[model samples]
Target: MWVTSSTATALLPTAIALGNFDGIHRGHQEVVRSIVGVDATGSEDCSIRRTVVTFNPHPREFFSGQRRQLLTPQEEKVRLLEALGIEQLVLLPFDRELATLSPQDFVEKILVRQLQAKRIGVGKDFHFGYQRQGTAEDLRAIAQNHDIEVKIVSLQACGRDRVSSSLIRQSLQEGDIPQANRLLGRPYQLAGTVVTGQQLGRTIGFPTANLQLPDNKFLPRYGVYSVRVVLEKTALLGVMNIGCRPTVNAEAKPTVEVHLLDWSGDLYEQTLTVNLEEFLRPEQKFSSLDALKAQIQTDCKRAKDLLNSQL
Candidate 1:
């Protein structure tokens, strides 16, 4: 039900929500949830398709730097939007050709010519077009000319601050896991493929699944954490370390090591999601392997208590 610009020749008469939807945070959800037509109530629409329009390469990253860490990759975005009742996902490439579109051109080319959208839901602060000249007001004015309707949703707030991906990223960078989790409406998670490790954990009676995070994925503060491990069909309780293994004299390159308390499977080369529930402490270099193993045991106990309470 999801297609990029290259594959999209035609689409259904959809009611569309437009934005990057990075992190798919609370504020972004408000825009998607507002597409319930003039009556405004249901999360899903049975009469017509509900679609999401987001840009590939994120406009911010396209204009700025490729080194920017993405909150949710395109694959992850598809899953989250699908759960929120979006039937179609449209990805517009954010290259120079798209960047040159004027406000009027954008309204005609994509919103009308391609989508033929029944309704459009956007944030009050949403902007588009060449040089970022278009505003929500501009969109509404143009929509009236085309006999289309637009809904502008107000921003959602977390405590005194507005909920935003930037704010969430900042919280994670600072290692404020609880604050980040609260804003996300879920735990902050990172996904990576399990790779071979030096077998140091097994030598100490604790075996671990080592993960090398993808290059473009954002990482939180380098430290130890209480986490939830997501396998293919089930979740497990775990403790994780996010850093180079200083005690073992490993390389300076950072890696993730997860020790699932109740899991004994062979996870090599398998992709897994590690959800950071709470920050346990900064990664420390124990003077001895015995000390490191003992501290890990302590961390396991702490993680089990926290996870059991969640259950």
Candidate 2:
């Protein structure tokens, strides 16, 4: 999909899907699919673009003192939407002005004037406008005046629980990789550039490529994960550690280190995208180097078995 900022001028009529789309989980995907589906099943309108209108800094980040962690961040979010066949992405800035626009103004200015949307889609719980006063029904009522078709997608669920970004975050925080993956419709991933480390892993005979996760990136429970690593054109099975390495040094902060099985090469300054397939154990302090090395060997074996079974 082609990405355009909010300030860019819009010329084509669009079938737009609107939301923060934090994780772009199953529910978000369903909503997006509906937009693509509409374009597919409706009349051949060459001017109608399949577009996604998402926000930056997220809405919650503006209203609260605490910063919220993101599942897909901005770059990854774009990649995911593009993969879903969206034709256009309009990343609107979320500021005081946008936060205070009335429901009517939002519809008139964004949906009508800026996007020229012929049809729009969102999840059932979507709210917009000043003080979050608008509802799906309100959106429907307002957009109709501009001859816009509305699609309010139903809530998706995982068994009894609703499928939502918050729920997925909770799963990731709790290190429930399988649950998070189930809700996300895919494995939860962290993409970052591989940076140089202390090279302590080399002494332990398990040299690692250290990753520099993006700012405010959401991390699962601190420990070990059985992961799939994407290194340039090759995919490799790997065991990743997300911890401070207490067995080595107590003064250090947490870091992500990956030991790729059956592969060896210089990876510094390269991008490495790690998909957390399963959580193995929590980070803990060990008494001796031998104990840590023995445990790491066990972890590697367990990770290999888990990763191999999936293949």
Candidate with maximal lDDT: 2
Q: Count of backbone clashes for each model?
A: 0, 0
Q: What's the CA error at residue 251 for candidate 2, in Å?
A: 4.9
Q: Alpha carbon lDDT of residue 221, candidate 1?
A: 87
lDDT of 1 by residue, 1-311 (tens): 66656425546777889998889888888898777443233344476668888887788888886657778877777877888877788888889999999999998888887887778899989999999999999998998788778899998888987888999999998899988888888788888899998878989988999987767778888888999988987888999988888888967778889999977979999988889998888987899999998999999999999989988
Q: Write the per-residue lDDT of candidate 2 for residues 157-238, one digit (tens) a residue.
A: 9998899999999898899999999999998998999898999988989999999987788888999999999988889999
Clashes of 1: 0
Candidate 1 global lDDT: 0.84
**Cα error of candidate 1 at position 15, Å:** 1.7
Tell me how many residue pairs clash in candidate 2. 0
**TM-score to true structure, per model:** 0.91, 0.95
Angstrom error of the Cα, residue 18, model 1: value is: 0.7
Task: State the local distance difference test value for candidate 2.
Answer: 0.88
